[model samples]
Every structure is written in structure tokens, then in C-alpha cells.
Target: MTPRPFSGFEWLIAWRYLRARRSEGGVSVMTWISLIGIALAVFALIATLAVRSGFRSEFTGVILGANAHVTVYAQTYNDEFGRPTRAIRDFDGVAERLQAVEGVTRAAPMVRGQVMLAANGRNSGVEVFGQRPADVQTIPLLAEPERARGDIARLADGVAIGQGVARELNVGVGDKVTMISPNGVQGPFGTTPRISHFEVVYIFAVGRYDIDRTRLYMPLSEAQTFFNHQDTVDEIEVLVTRPDDVAAMIAPILDATGPDYFTWTWRDSSGGFLRALEMEDNIMFVILSILVLIATMNITSGLIMLVKNKGRDVGVLRTMGLSEGSILRVFFICGASIGVAGTIIGVVAGSLFAIYIDPVFGFVNWLLGGGVWDPSVRFLSALPAELRWEDVAKAVGLSLGLSFVVTIFPARRAARLDPVEALRYE
Candidate 1:
């Protein structure tokens, strides 16, 4: 009687063929090579996807945590002196209106000035932001006790400096620093530079080297005085409940603040960088897919070899009333078994690596005497990994698909073996 498709006997015969001894012409060796190749490829793909996801998440989190989701700038116009001036004279009213808008969490009127900071015989140019102490406390990064040192309540008493700036200026809490601005006093000769002194009462490390290295914060009153703005603010910084929804909030925000003010979202400022990241992610996925394909090609080579070595067996089975379809299924089972096993192994390994990436990197850094990750250079304190289920599914599907597709030609060749010629040779 003809055996049912993929019956017990088919599996038995396929497994027996796979277990062929090494002395039987190295079929098992090739199987191991194919299995290892596929496993490593899947692992690499999963690990890369996890890192990409994590990096994007961390970068965006930093951007939103340390800065406003949207900034509303006053329209610049030629003054009576024909010089361009941009300031919101009704900043408090506009900010109160913006805070009343739906989805707005906080609306802070702030003064921003570019100045040179000098302390301990060291000097660095930095951007200074001036806001109320209450509003300053709303900054997520600054609110973190671990990331920020000193008192937010005393912000009006002095100033808050970034960790990198403190390091550069060799100053800390209660230390003195002088700020010099080019937009100081208008004298008969030209514009006289304005210089002011303040004590640093807080220091924050926001993880992004660029921001940490060049940011300082002062009380709004002090900043307005220093920047020569009388009862005016440079912009109104608005924070929303969901930063990702800032684009959708533009209309409501404009309606609240009136048309005299134009809004700039975080996306508008850093959109190109985020787009570049997305493009890199897609390119990386394609490259890794090619790698998985290459690894699965080994399945083709191993199956071809297995078919050649099992020719005499195929001939005998065909003579014993086994149809060509049964023969094909038998060999298909052999190749597919390796693929399934390898994929399972790879998924487990990749998931674990992503989950425990920090400790794994710690071990690696220890092995190499430390310094594997540099926050100053990478803009993150440590390597990050976020395993996504969709990425894992994609890897599994690609691996198994390539394996099955490559097995077909070899399985068909085995099924079409001429019984008469095969047994004649035997």
C-alpha cells in the first residue's frame, strides 16, 4: 500500500538519513554547518534590530525630556530705529492662554541669550535659558534626583549650570561665574558688551553631550535684565502631555496664542536627524536579510549532498512501491527539521541577549579593560537594546522561508532519481 504523505515511516526514514555517521561521507557535518550558519544569521538580525529600536527610543526620550515640545516665537519686525526686534511683550498673558489649551501641560515664558561663561580662569560660550523656578522644576531631566544636583527652589537665588559646563569651567554649586553678552548697552561708539556675575546653585546632566556641554539656566527676571529685555520674553516654551502629538497641537496652540506668534515643534528642529535614523534602520534590515539569505543557502548545499549520498536508498524505496511524492517529502523533512531547530535556537539566544544587553556589555567591557561605551561620543550613557516581537517574527519567517525554498530543488532531484540506473550502479 502507498504510504500516506509525511507518515511515520517517512519521518523515520528522514531522521535515519540525517543521523548518518560521519564515516558515511560527511552528510551530518554539512547539516551541522547549515544549522550553525542559520542560527548565527538570525541572532545577528535580532540583535541589530533591538539595538536600533533602543537607540531611537533613548534619543527621542532625551530630546523631549530636556527641552520643550513646542516653542512659540514672537514675530520679528523692524523697530522705529529700523533694527529687527523679536520679543513677546504680553508673554505672561500669552503663556497663561497657552496653558489653558487642551493637551498643554506647561507653558513657560523664557528669555534666551547667547553668552560667554568664565570661571576658574576657564571660559566657554554657552546658551542661557531664563525661566521661573517653578517652571524649571517641570523639566523632566532636571527633576530627576539622580541626574540633577542642588536646589531647584534656589534657582531664583542664582543659576543652574550643566554638568559639562561645570566641568569645563571647574565650578560647582555655590561657585561664581560671569556671563558676557554682545547685545548689552547701546553706546555712541557701538554696542557695549554686557557682563554679569551669578552663583551656580544647580548642576544637571541630561545625558546628551551637546546639551550638557553648552547650557545654563537663570531666573527669568535676571535673564531679562541681563539680555536688556524689559518686561518681555524671547519665547514661550510649551510642554504637552504627549510630545509625539505636538504636530497635531499646532492649530490649537496658534488659536490660543494668536497669530502674532509662530510655533516650532521639536520635529521641525530635529526632523532631519530622525529621518536619517529611520533610513539607516531600513538599510540595516536589508543588509541583515541578505546575510540570512546567504546563511540559508547552506541548506541548499547540504541537502544536495544528502540527496547524492542517499541515491541508492531512494532507488530501493521507489522500487518498494513508494511514490515520488513520498520520497520528496522524506528529504523535505530532513532539511526543514534543521531549519526549525536552528530558528528556535536563534530566537531564544537573540531575545536573551537583548534583554540583558547592559550586563553583557559590562562583561565585554571588563574583558577588554573597560571603555566600551563613551557617553560623550555616543550621546548615551550606555548601550541600549529593546527587543521587538515583530522583528523576531520577521527573522523567523525569513529564515524558515529561505530554508524551505532552497530545499525544494534538491528534494525534487532526489524524487526524480531513476530507480533502474541507481540499483544498476548499486
Candidate 2:
């Protein structure tokens, strides 16, 4: 049996040191604090990254859902003459040509402009989009028939408002709202906004404030009449078969629409929101990584203190034929044990917290009594979490790697203990 292996004994001693109480010359208060700190740092980093990833995912889906993948706008959106000089005159033909383009799943004409919505003695600024309700492709993702309290089919004859708008105005389906177009007919009276009232045939919730709180749908003919633009359309909305292929699909779409038309993807028109999210995620990662780095340093300090406390043990072990290499191995096991345990627990706890985030927030809201994740104030009704294995892997790897690297200093110091000096004091 060769009296068993020295590695096994070293691990045995390390495990004992971790489990021993202060009365038995075991792990100190600082060691426990360091262990807990590292675990918390890992937890915070993992949960925060998950939150950021979830936001990006939610926002992207909302953007893609509420709007077309690509839009072929006239050369210039508007001209100084208060007229859309490049308005698509041949809307039907342009839509037909665009639909024939490769990668284009669907094409339809759309009109959008800012308007003031007044209902139930309340007024709110709103964005109006004119489209034929018969074309299901152009409707918002959350504006499905299941969620609507009124008839979505009436969009062409009446108006469809968002849930937020309905709430703010305290109006429901069958209510009438006045829509005043900002771009109205110019007259000698220095221009007056064109106002029209329509029955609120539908109320939608797009899960986005910009669209839900400020968006309305009307019939193309009504919009044309109100905006004083007839026999033409503002733009052509296009849906792509594959969202990722939007950039590639651009060339063919532009060619099909002719040089007179300008094509813009959803990403292009998101007002730099996509780039801002990426930048925010990067910045947050770096900031949280710094916190994690500080926590890892505690492992080194704890190991150093443990080595200083166990100097006499090293001498006795060396006298019993233990080598300096074995001494180093013992300390490595001690320090690495804490790191490994903390990392494992952190991963499990953090993952569970992130994955079940909805329930967690629900509990919080219940305890705090509202204001936890209000949809009116928050983009989502509950906190969103999208856990990425890559992020978890990076966090675990960094913690374990740093723990290993930190052990070298204290382990080397313990291994260098002079047996003679250590024994003379005893």
C-alpha cells in the first residue's frame, strides 16, 4: 500500500483545515468572509449579465414585431413645400415589385405621422400608422385578436389604439377618439390641424411604451383624407423571410424599388438603440468584473494568513518525511477548496435566481406592494432574464482561474518554511 499516497494525505489535511473550528486552528473569520464575498460577486455578475441579455432580446423582438423588417421610403421623407415630393405614386405596383424581390416575405403600403389623440376628456400625443387591416402582416405582434377587446377587422373603417393609450384616456372599445393630424391642410388661416373622430374598434398592447402608449392604426383612405395626401402613400413596408438576412436582402430590395426609393431596415431606424445596448452591456461587464477581481484577491489574503497560522504543522510534517512539494500541495488544496465550493454554489443559486426571475419579482412586488415591475413604468411587467452559457462559463472560469493563481504566493511561502527554525521555536 506504500502507506497510502502523500497526495491523498495532503487533501485529507486540507479538507480537515476547511472543516475545523477556530478552537482547532482551522479556517478563520476572514477566510469565511472571503469565500462568501467571492460567491456573491459571481452571483451579482451572472444575474446582471442575464438581465442585460434579456433586455436586448426583448427590445429586439419588440422592434422587429411592431415594425417592418425593411421600409422603402421616398427619396426624402418630406419637402419644404409641406408636400412629400417623393411619395410613392404607384403604391400597388411598387408593393408588387418589392414582394417579388428575393428574401422579401411580404410587401405592403404604410403611412405614419404624429397626431394628437383626445378621448374621454383626456389628450395624449400619439403616432399614427395608416394601413389596411386586411393585411395581417403589417399588424403589430401584440395586437392580436385574442388581446383585443374590439374588432381588429374594423381597423380600416375605425381606429385601433394601444392598451396604454386606452388606459390613459380611460376609454375602452366602442369609445370615440379625435385624431388631429399635425401635418394638416394649409390655408390662409396659417394652417389648422385636420381633426377626425373615429370609434376605437381595437385596443392593442405591443409591450413597448413607444408603440403602445403612442401608436394608433387607421385606414389608409382615412389617413390620406386627413393628411391631404391621396392617390399616393408614404412608404412601402416589407417583411423578410429571415431577419438576420436583412442586410443581405437590402441590395435586391433597393434595386427592385429603383433609385428613386430609399430602403431602411428596422435596425437602421432604431435611433442607435441597438448600438447603445451593446455598449451598455460591455461597460457593465467591465465594471462588474472589477468587483469580482477584488473579491478574488481576498482568497490570496486568506491563504497567506492560513499559512502563517500553520507554520509549526509544516515543521512537524517535514520531520515526518513530508517534502516541501507536499507542503505546497496541502495549501493549494485548502485555498482551492474554498474557491471551488463558492463557485459551484454561486453558479447554481445565480442560475436559479435568473431563470425563475418572474416569480422572484412577483414575490418582491407582493412584499413591497406594487412598484416592483409596473408595465406602465417598466418595459416589461416583470424582470426579464436571458441566461447565456457563455457568460456563466466566463464567470466560472475567471473565478476558478483567479483562485488558482492566487494560491501560488501563499503556497510557495508555506513550502519555503525552514524546518530547523520552525522546530527551534517549539
Candidate 3:
């Protein structure tokens, strides 16, 4: 008749009821449904997070490789307006000084100009970039693994054209192309539009249509002479050891430049894409979490039904002096057990699938005739999956929290059952 003694005994009986319910005819169906729901929901969430993270990581690499981590340009409203007015002196020494900065890995100067590329009477507007061969190869990580080539110093009057540009111009390596600049050269009579020709020594296909179609790279001297910039540059590109440190690294360089130039990071150049990815992640998390919540609600319903079916047992236990707290703990433990088992299964399934997603995508790509993850059309060259422990932990925590909270209603209802009414019920 002791209430305290009944606490331990009530839990023992509660556990038996929980285990016994699995064998009950209708209860097993509902239990399996609830378990499957939680497992599938958690699995989907984890897998989706991994793929999204992979996309961001790989695309960021492409951007970093194609451009510098940080760019220092003349501080006018725009580079075009400021190029003539601003003076960027000591550029050669600037690269060495920037290398001494804590985070900077390398620095280089580049001349940028807008010009028309003409070949065989076919013309396309392009952006020409001029860089010293040594500096060009040093800053951005541009290695043609497919070609097994080491450096791109072969780009003398040589040029690397994008796949799109090459197709449009019908040009290839060893072809001659002419660049006509709108910036005219000084003449005895007046300024005259200048035309310069360069031989394409090497070609690089970065898989970005906009970059490939509109970009052309050549030696720094040719670009300067062609653009009429005898001893000045359009911008300075700095590569950093850690991309995350780009903003912090800019402060000292900006101070060194003494406000004559403005520094920009890759994040600044590609803000729109980065923000889009962030928004997508948030949306996916919210949408997927709702599924787990819906599954938890199912668990709540199943537990409530079980409590009703076992009303007589609960009433008899109360009559035997079981405490409400003990009754509540029993039901809670039962529900939590279901959640834990489902979560374990889901975590295992999700991790395995995420780890193999890249290979799966590659296989799919081969099956689809090499078009599953087209770098030419899509930002990501292949399916990417990046598993983060933090994401997994968040999912587990969410599942557990939802599962525990859902048990409260059923647990409380069973604990508060009236023994007298329940004992009289047939």
C-alpha cells in the first residue's frame, strides 16, 4: 500500500506493457507506421543537407580558382572611370609586400580591358586579362589535371579561351586572333583605334559559359601595350592561404595602399550565388523538419490509443497505489524507445547514402550519356555530398526533442485516469 514502493513496481509493469503492445494485433501496425515515418523523414533531411553542402563547397572552389581571393582595384566609382585617373605604382614590389602579410599566399597585377575579338570575319565581345606568366600561375590554383600540364607560362602572346568562346569563334590552339580596343592610341592627327594580334598557345575550358565566352588571357606586356597602359595596371589580385581570412587580410593591404584603392573579396564578387545557397539551405531545413514533427504527432496518436486500450490495467495499478509520476515515466520510456530505434536506423541509412552520393551521381551520369551533372550547364560539375557532424547532430536533437514532447499528452492522460470509473468499465 506504500506509494513509494509502487513507483518502482509501476515502472516494471509499464515496461512489460510497452513490450507486450508490439504483439497486439492493431497496435503493431500503428507502431510500424510511426517508426517508418520517423526513419524516412530523418534520412531525407540528412541526405539533403549533405548534397547541398557539397554543392556550395565545389562551386566555391571553381570561383576561387577562376578569380583571386581578393582583388584591389582603382578606387573610383568604377574601374573604367578610375583606370586613367588613378596611378598604381610599385606593382612589382607590391606583390612581394603582400606575400609578407600573414594570410596572403601570393599577389599579382593584371590589366583588364574590353575589346572585340575577330577571327575569319566572325566577332565576339570579350574581356581581355593580362598578367605576368609567373604571377598568373602562382595566385589562382589553375591546374589542368585532364591535360596533366604543370604551368601555363606557354601563354606568351598565347591565350586561354573558354569553351564557349572557342566554339563561337571556331578557334583552337595555334590560331591567330585579333583584339581591337575601343581605347584609341595617340596619333599625329588624332587618336586612332588600335588593333593587335596574338597567337593562342594554350586553351583552357573552365566550363563556365559567361567566363569562357567573354574572357581571354594573354601576357601582361601585350595587354598593357594593346590597351595603351604603358606602366599601370587595372587591378591587383591577391591569393590567400585561407579564403575565410580574405576580409581580415584586406585591412592591412588597404592601409598600405592608403585609400587610393578598394579591396574586394571573392564573396563580394559572388554574393548573389552564396546568398541563394544559404536561403535554399534554410528552406530545406524547415521543410524537412516538418516531416519529423508530423511523424512525432503520429507517435503521440499511437501512444494515446494504447493508453485508452490499457485503461483497465492503469486503473488496477492506481488502485495498487502507483504514483502518477511513475505512471508518466513508464509511458515516456516506451515512446522514447520507439524514437531512439527509428533514429538509429535513419542515421545509419542517411550517412551511408550521403557518402556514396558522388559515385552514384557519376554512375547515373554515365547511364544518362554523360549529361547527368553537366558542368557546362550547371554550376556543380558533379553531384556533391558533404556530411557535417553538426548537421547530423541537429537532426538527431530535433528528432529526440519532438519524440519526447509528443509523449507528454498520452503520459499525462494515462497517469490521471480515474481508477473507480476504469475498474467498473467492461
lDDT of 1 by residue, 132-239 (tens): 989999988887733777887899889998898999999989899999888999999999999999999999887788888889989999998998888988999999
Candidate 2's residue-wise lDDT over 94-123, tens digit each?
Answer: 899988987787797877788889987899
* Backbone clashes counted, model 2: 0
The 10-residue segment with the lowest total lDDT in model 1: 143-152
Judging by TM-score, tell me the better candidate of 1 and 3: 1
Q: Which candidate should be chosen as best, given lDDT against the real structure? A: 1
- Please, what are the lDDT tens digits per residue for candidate 3 over residues 1-426? 446533666567655765665545125567788888889988998999998888787678677877888988766543455533544556776667777777777788889888898887799998888888777665343444223122366876577666567678888777888878767777798878898887777666554556656777788988888877788887888888888667777788776666667888998988788899999999999999998999878889888888888788778878877778877877887677778878888888899889988677778778988856555667443567889998899889989899999988899998898889989955
TM-score of each: 0.94, 0.90, 0.82
For model 1, the superposed segments whose C-alpha errors exceed 4 Å read 1-4, 80-82, 188-190
Off by over 4 Å in 3: 1-26, 75-84, 87-89, 118-124, 144-151, 167-197, 205-213, 319-322, 362-377
* Candidate topping TM-score: 1
- The Cα error of candidate 3 at residue 340, in Å, is 1.7
Assess candidate 3 and give its TM-score to the true structure: 0.82
